[model samples]
Target: MPNERLRGAVSARELTTQRCAELLGVDPKTVERWITRDRVPHRAHRVAAADLLGVDETYLWPSVVDDLRTVSAGRAEMVEFYPSRSAVPLELWRSLIQQARESVDILVFAGLFLPELHDITQLGERARQGCRIRVLLADPNGAAVRRRGDEEGFGVGLAHRVLLSLRYYEPILAIPGVEVRLHDTTLYASIFRVDETMLVNTHVYGSTAAHNPVLHLRRVPGGRVVDHYLTSFDRVWTHAKRTSDINAVIAAFDGR
Candidate 1:
């Protein structure tokens, strides 16, 4: 059993032993043991566990337990939906993107990958209009493809084809405001934030990526905890790669 003091600090939601065990491919008993014994898992496993819990490492393995208690007590209104149409609401995406007068940062497997969605002229127009437009995408051709250079196999891959078409936005490489990267991590997640507001897309509970539900949440006044969550995203953005590396594969679909 965990220390009585420690038990007092962890919330019911954060103590999701059953869900964490499912994600870790372990029995719920094992998860309880880890928490009871205060045995920290490997770094990668802890990160995975945190993702499964829909919170950050700071929430799970924080240096100060009191901080976790403080944050876990706070809550925000949330909405969940799946945009079954060809694309998520363009107006909604644009609204979030446009709100970034200081910067627009997107991190996803494929950023605006649908041909129907590539509107850099408009995006660039936004950039030109002074909103700092930026993105961190998985390599457009990161996944192994049966076809030499076809773009329609994977849901995210198909969406990537549209992003590859707009190359003039060069130098949108992996530098602070702009980045493109590929990761094999199962943390296939998407986030959009405008100041304190955040929209999180979870690729869970669906057979495929496109059908997964997205959760939208806004930061209430005087509640700034979401900022730390956004900060974690910036950390991931900092490590992403450039589009140039996957140009060859993406180029093959020209005129398709």
Candidate 2:
């Protein structure tokens, strides 16, 4: 059963289309359009829905539950922005994954799984070392891969270049001890958990995320942080569609 606390705090009654439109200050036809497009009440309407339900707007969107909880505790979270062209220096990211002994679960958005850029080869080595390594990444697609090519020409056609970017990380995915999944969500961040410690790297460029901040969430075990991350990862993984026909390498571990 869902938490009674959560249910008691939130009203489950579904609002009518007309009622929802009235709350959002939009014409009923506009609401119908949103339904047709599947965009729903969206961010703007979220606020109004919360007011209607007499609950925190976060309640309407299950994802925001963590943010609401985090804020209520007076925890400080930073948001940093950087231009798209300049690379983000995240050395801690490498260290976290490299030293994992028991398990490593990673969630990344716009991460180039390249051996040269990062020690992706090390992931395979760790996998062979009997550590559980799972990576969830955004799928390369129209909007996702659009900027990669225009930023720098990798001497390949648009599609091939995108494929190459994804292929470069195949060694990590092919590792028998690792599970790789491609997710399609705007939640652009990676959580690398090494046992009890968690390092969250937020990779963003341009307007969507300014000064992409990497949040390091730390607390002892049983705080429910790691469990929450695992749940989120699984949600993305189960919904993610698998990528097919990964390139084969002569020296698989070597990433040749």
Candidate 3:
């Protein structure tokens, strides 16, 4: 049977067999065989081709599940772990945002530290440079925010902090390629993803997010950890309300 997944991935990338071969340093006939004859390439070629096509290697070759090395590579996805979110270096945060070429996706309650630590204008600049940015902040007026506030002993302060953070984001909300949404869902983890690399801050009961542990993950082929969080982010984003009128959102919260 032909490897339709490989054929589709290459076609989706608009890459001809000859172009794929050129990039992979293989003959066009070999590339064709991989797709038409369902020939599984060597481990190195598998990784390289997957990276080029922007899909998991296993998706192209299901037989990879039997490869223990591929499973090991998935576990290696966690690049580092910080004892607390505050323990992460400021430079590292800046580097991650600065190096992003494709997308920057953030899901948090307030994430007030972001605009405070780094100039939020950089996000606008990034959007202008063709990078898609999506930010999901908790709805200040929602029950989830109030409940989180009570859990953290912040009362109504968490809502206020989210408002303040929204002010910082207001200017960039109108930027093309940038989207800001408000989600009322209980956020289990705060995700800051810059392209394939992500910083995941896991929330704990009765603890402030700044004190929470953070996992630094870079997406690797067949990695389940990063994809799991990414999927969560997308789910929240789907149900989140897009904020087009910043003043209206604030007014609604204030009126409530």
Candidate 4:
């Protein structure tokens, strides 16, 4: 079940030593020998196992997982680094968002990454279950968007993306336990958190978001990283305009 909890560790098919050996045209004893010796299969067999099991090699060998895990309290618990935003599994995202008990917070431009990917009804159910959802999106017409556009030479392209992102959640503006806001300030990083776990996507100049590194951090006692990120989310949420008032916020920028 622990392996099941990890996205890439489970297979759609049965994966026993006999099954793996059959896939590799080897004896079951060969597979058992590798397991007993605490070793992985050879390169070719490893690939075959991964193929038959429908998992990544890293998923089978946690010690060699490409993702980084930072140690704390000498326990090496509660921090991860996915190679890229897309590399983080959709299941993990859904699991975190659906399991939140206290709060689910998101701060980003257009907010398309999460909103567009998930079912709004499921999110509403989470709210009905007492999880507070706060979403902050960049105001397409705001100064921050303009600066980013000018800096990136994208002009209206970035602004249009923000507008599109906002529309994804417009229908859920009235959903209980869910609140949306539009922020005008410079966005340093995009943050998505569900209760104690937080995923950070830092902005890199001239680079697309999908190409950026992602840091996944779980709350640890006296941990400054998670604390700072949550604090920042709170601060931004305070200054952001409510979804219903976002038009007024934009009008002020347009000198309406």
| Candidate 4: tens digits of C-alpha lDDT, residues 50-147 | 55665555556555433233234213324778878888888988888778898989988765667667876667778888889888888777888778
**What value of lDDT does candidate 3 attain over all alpha carbons?**
0.92
Clashing pairs in 3: none
Deviating ranges (above 4 Å) for candidate 4 = 1-78, 245-256
Among all windows of 10 consecutive residues in model 3, the one with the lowest summed lDDT is 221-230
Worst 10 residues of 2 by lDDT: 77-86
Model 2 segments beyond 4 Å from truth?
1-91, 113-117, 142-162, 203-205, 208-210, 247-256
Q: Please write out the lDDT profile of model 2 over residues 1-256, one tens digit for every residue.
A: 2333233433355566677667768887775554454333455465555556655544444555555444543243222333421244456556766777878776654445334456677878888999987766555553443453343342223335334555666756766887776666656456666765665555554432224565566543123344456567777778876654455321231342
**TM-score for each of the candidates:** 0.51, 0.52, 0.76, 0.65
Cα miss at 227, model 3 (Å)?
1.2
Query: What lDDT score is found at residue 171 in candidate 2?
Result: 59
For the record, the alpha-carbon RMSD of candidate 3 to the native fold, in angstroms, is: 5.3
Better of 1 and 2 by lDDT: 2
Pairs of colliding residues, candidate 1? 113-159, 113-160, 180-241, 181-241
For all candidates in order, the CA lDDT equals 0.51, 0.54, 0.92, 0.70
Per-candidate Cα RMSD to the true structure, in Å, reads 11.5, 12.3, 5.3, 16.4
- List model 3 lDDT by residue over 1-256, tens digit each: 8999999999999999999999999999999999999999998899799879977777899898778877887788989999999999999999888888899999999999999988898999999999999999999999999999999999899999999999999888888999999999998999999999999999999999999999999989656678778878989999999898878888998998
